[model samples]
Target: AGWQGTAAQVVTHTLNRMQDEFATNPADCLAYIGTCITQPHYEVDERVASRLPETHLKPGGKPGKWMADLKGANLAQLLSAGIPEAHIEVSPYCTWADNDHYFSHRRNEGTTGRMLAVIGIQNKPS
Candidate 1:
């Protein structure tokens, strides 16, 4: 399903909820991949659009439609929640725009898709 609220709201709520149960902070570092700010994927209510950051919203091609910057919104929320700017890295790629490199359910009309995520810790030099 699509985002229930602005990306900022969704990200903030999720981080807060995770913090409640996790022993460590979730805002230490963030790496965003796919679905970049370049894609105008949201058509939201004006009230919700008003809450989004300036860089995170733009006029959609059609009236009453607004393109939202998903990654920008999440980055804003993470920074507002005390995460350092240096610790956050946002990818320049957009899954919706790059069909050959990424899978997008919306672009494919729910026919098929795949998810990939990777995380690792580097070993300290002796």
Candidate 2:
């Protein structure tokens, strides 16, 4: 879902897909929680911006542009879908701001190395 479209579209589409998974398997959906990278200054078309909340959006430096909060938008979607706030976690790191520790296609011009994170539940022996 990397820059597939405007932040609004990406967040909405991603939440829809997650909701589908939740419907099929609520337990697994809860276990598969994760966060989208924060986009402090994501520019989007006015049309897209209009669909997002004003609280999660900021005026871009130029006209007809917007800075979106992709993380906050995703979080709100999870909350609306009944995901507990305690079960959800948001990373404070911004890839662009933490270029030394994270890969940011926008900051690095798509020349950065890949990064991977994995989480799972280990069942107790029965």
Candidate 3:
């Protein structure tokens, strides 16, 4: 699938699952995703920053793309879903727009060479 289609599908599926989980246990239905940095002309609203403790706003690096808080956007989503302000956690590092450690879609000028890291835990019988 194309990027937009894939993203839409993932979001739709996640929302459906969240609704189901919330019906049973509301507290268990938390969603977290990394958001792309937007232009500074767009405001990073206070409802987001209040929850995330480690949001950074880097200045004057790129022309159109300003350093934004991905975790802040996620925290804002959680807060909008009625989750407590203290429950969310934000990373200290700026993902793409700031450091070279992470690949940026914006910086690459629409290149398809992005890398991602995912972690999970497996259950073991004791």
- The true-versus-predicted C-alpha distance at residue 8 of model 1, in Å, is 7.2
The sequence of per-residue lDDT tens digits that candidate 3 reaches over residues 1-126 is 122323234434544565675552324443444434443422333443333333344443444333344444445546656555565444444334553665455566566356554533233479
TM-scores for all candidates: the values are 0.65, 0.65, 0.44
Indicate the worst ten consecutive residues by lDDT in candidate 2. Answer: 24-33
Please give the RMSD of candidate 1 to the true structure. Answer: 4.5
lDDT of 2 by residue, 5-116 (tens): 4343554455566556544322334523233346564677787778777777888888998887766766676666556677677777777777788877777887978877
TM-score of 2: 0.65
* Cα lDDT over the full model 3: 0.43
Mind giving the per-residue lDDT tens digits that candidate 1 earns over 1-126? 134455437656766766675533654646453343244554555666676676877887777667767666777777776667887777777667776777766667777566666644333489
Query: Which residue runs of candidate 3 sit more than 4 Å off their true CA positions?
Result: 1-16, 21-24, 29-35, 38-71, 117-126
lDDT of model 2 at position 88 = 72
How big is the positional error of residue 24 in model 2, measured in Å on the Cα after superposition? 6.9
Stretch of 10 with least lDDT, candidate 1:
31-40
